[model samples]
Target: MFLHLGGSTVISLKGVIGIFDYSLTKTNHVNNYFNNGKKIIKICEDDEFKSFIITNKEIYLSPIAANTLKKRINSQNFTEKVNILQEHPTFK
Candidate 1:
């Protein structure tokens, strides 16, 4: 499954480590350290960033809210599970 961060940015869900509220970065030193040297790909055009997505290979700054992104992930999980169940012999 793939998750859309915003704009044209779509990432593989398998590689995603976490999705976090951008505001947390303001107070978290660990987040600050990650931002110091890593290349952050901003998905939105404007400077307003509501969330950040941490993946296996890259970090993304997204304009979409963290809750929205989380919902998307949850929905994907639900759909995938349904598909798997439908493919089972018992479902046939």
Candidate 2:
């Protein structure tokens, strides 16, 4: 799923696997946030502080759906988890 936040910026939630099993989960929070028009907000006083709150709120409210968003916001790169299906000859 891809979310376009007003401008050119976009949030992509792809290749997300749920706990217990490597099954893809639907990103519901992203849709809800966008639909509610809470993507961007304007703050007059303590702009920096308010910005932080907005960012944190976005993450706290949505964990599974916001996994990719959190990574991007925190400047962390995404790395796929190793697949269990692949066989390692060294282990055998």
Among these predicted structures, which one has the highest TM-score? 1
Model 2 Cα shift for residue 27 (angstroms)? 15
How much does each candidate deviate from the true structure in C-alpha RMSD? Answer: 11.3, 15.3
Return the TM-score for each candidate structure: 0.73, 0.18
lDDT of 1: 0.69
Tens digits of lDDT, candidate 2, 1-92: 44322224344434222211111112344335435544333222222211111232231122222333343434544354412211223323
Tens digit of lDDT per residue, candidate 1, span 20-90? 77766655554565767666788876568888777777778899888788788787763432111102232
lDDT of each: 0.69, 0.29
Candidate 2 ranges beyond 4 A from true positions: 1-64, 76-92
- Looking at model 1, the pairs that clash are none
